[model samples]
Target: MNHTIPLALSIAGTDPTGGAGIQADLKTFQEREVYGMSVITSVVAQNTIGVQDVHHIPLDFIESQLKSVLSDLPPHSVKTGMIATPEMMEMIAAYLRNQSIPYVLDPVMVAKSGHALMDPASQDIVREALVPLATIVTPNIPEAEILVDFQIQDLYDAQRAAKVLVEELGAEAAVVKGGHLKGEAVDILYVNNRFYTFPSIRTNTKHTHGTGCTFSAVLAAELAKQKSIVEAVSIAKKFITDAIRYTLNIGNGNGPTNHWGYRLKNIPTVKGENHHV
Candidate 1:
């Protein structure tokens, strides 16, 4: 029997440590039962401890990679992470303009270990050129502040930031992740002028590396499977929660989340309903 599975693509940097960036995306996609493809944007020397250095791929080569994948096996959904420069963002935005697939933009700015992953100058370019093209833009507290030009202190502030991302920054939808905030891990999603709050119990662990990339990758995978944005976000939330709950205490520093946690015996479900996808 010949089976055709949905394909999800990640246009992002590479994390050799296998915890974040393209590596995380591919792992998440596979776990979500979608075929995964990748276009490397930058080569980063990074591990669970921190990012040591970065080597950006040339612009022409990046474009060629995009063309090579998109022209032939166009993905069902696409997500971007760790775009290191403004020029790369510009090119990606130009390419995404002509495609009609779900685009999840994870504005990866800094690493969990406080290392800068993207150029500070590219923040504005991402807000202007890339955010507008995203089907849903996911940003943590600091990233949200940079995109909306405001301070996000609490849940209310996060909600406001979500609105600003959709109404002002031109994103079709926005998810302001509250992982950086105190208490529960609450993520607010704003789309079609409606708000949805997904709150999960915070796991007190230091192994949550690549969570942003993993979440966005899962979202893209669900969308690739034709699930609604709301469903996709909800499922992705559960996925990350489980992954964090079963943290992998590997490296000496902040280790990585367990990517296979969803398949564990105790994975949570949404509203007592099993997530079939």
Candidate 2:
């Protein structure tokens, strides 16, 4: 038998804390047995507690970084996180549209530490420029509401919003994350008029700093391996659930998830890598 590692790329920001952003994405890729590369859009000074400050990389630098990686080891799949500014989002959209790789967009509007990472004025640019090119867009409840410009109160509302996002925004699929729901953690996936509900018992720990980045990265990894969108999401849901269950209390506030949650023999095994892209 042969073991070959698939390569995946993350075009996003750098998190010094290693909880979210490029660090979290890379860790998730490694744990999933894929080679991970990154193009940093911004540099963030943050920890599990929160984002202290963010400095955007020059637009030219961002473009150069993309060309540098794609010109060499083109990724099997790509995931976008924490593209802080509208200009950065535009650049990413143009680059992705011209590429032939599968991509996942994690609409990271707000940081876990309660800081707004996106510009209010750039919402339109993101929706117009990037959302349509996504293989799938993973938006939490709050982010979904902003995209649809309406409040999503229940499962029904989420379903409605997902349909709109697919029909209007042109996303191939929409995963309306129900982590913010009052009780259990339920992620709702709406595609092709079918709704899949992924439910999990919520963890009591506050160490959920990198949950969003981790989830999207896992989804991208699964998709790159050729899993169907639904299958990829299912794997991601299980990965995140177990990660939250085994929460790492590494920081004083919200800590990070274990990207290597399934690496050990004792850990739960995910399905085989399909290698689509």
Which numbered prediction scores highest in TM-score against the true structure? 1
Q: Taking the tens digit of each residue's C-alpha lDDT, what string does model 2 give over 11-127?
A: 888888898889999988887778899999989898877778889899999999999988887888999988877888887888898878778999988655445556768878778
Q: List the residue pairs that clash in candidate 2.
A: 207-255, 225-274, 225-275, 225-276, 226-275, 226-276
Write down the TM-score for model 2.
0.91
RMSD of each: 3.7, 4.3
Q: What lDDT does each candidate get?
A: 0.88, 0.82
Q: After superposition, how far is residue 149 of candidate 2 from its true place, in Å?
A: 0.8
lDDT tens string, model 1, 196-227?
A: 88888898899988899999999999999999
TM-score of each: 0.94, 0.91
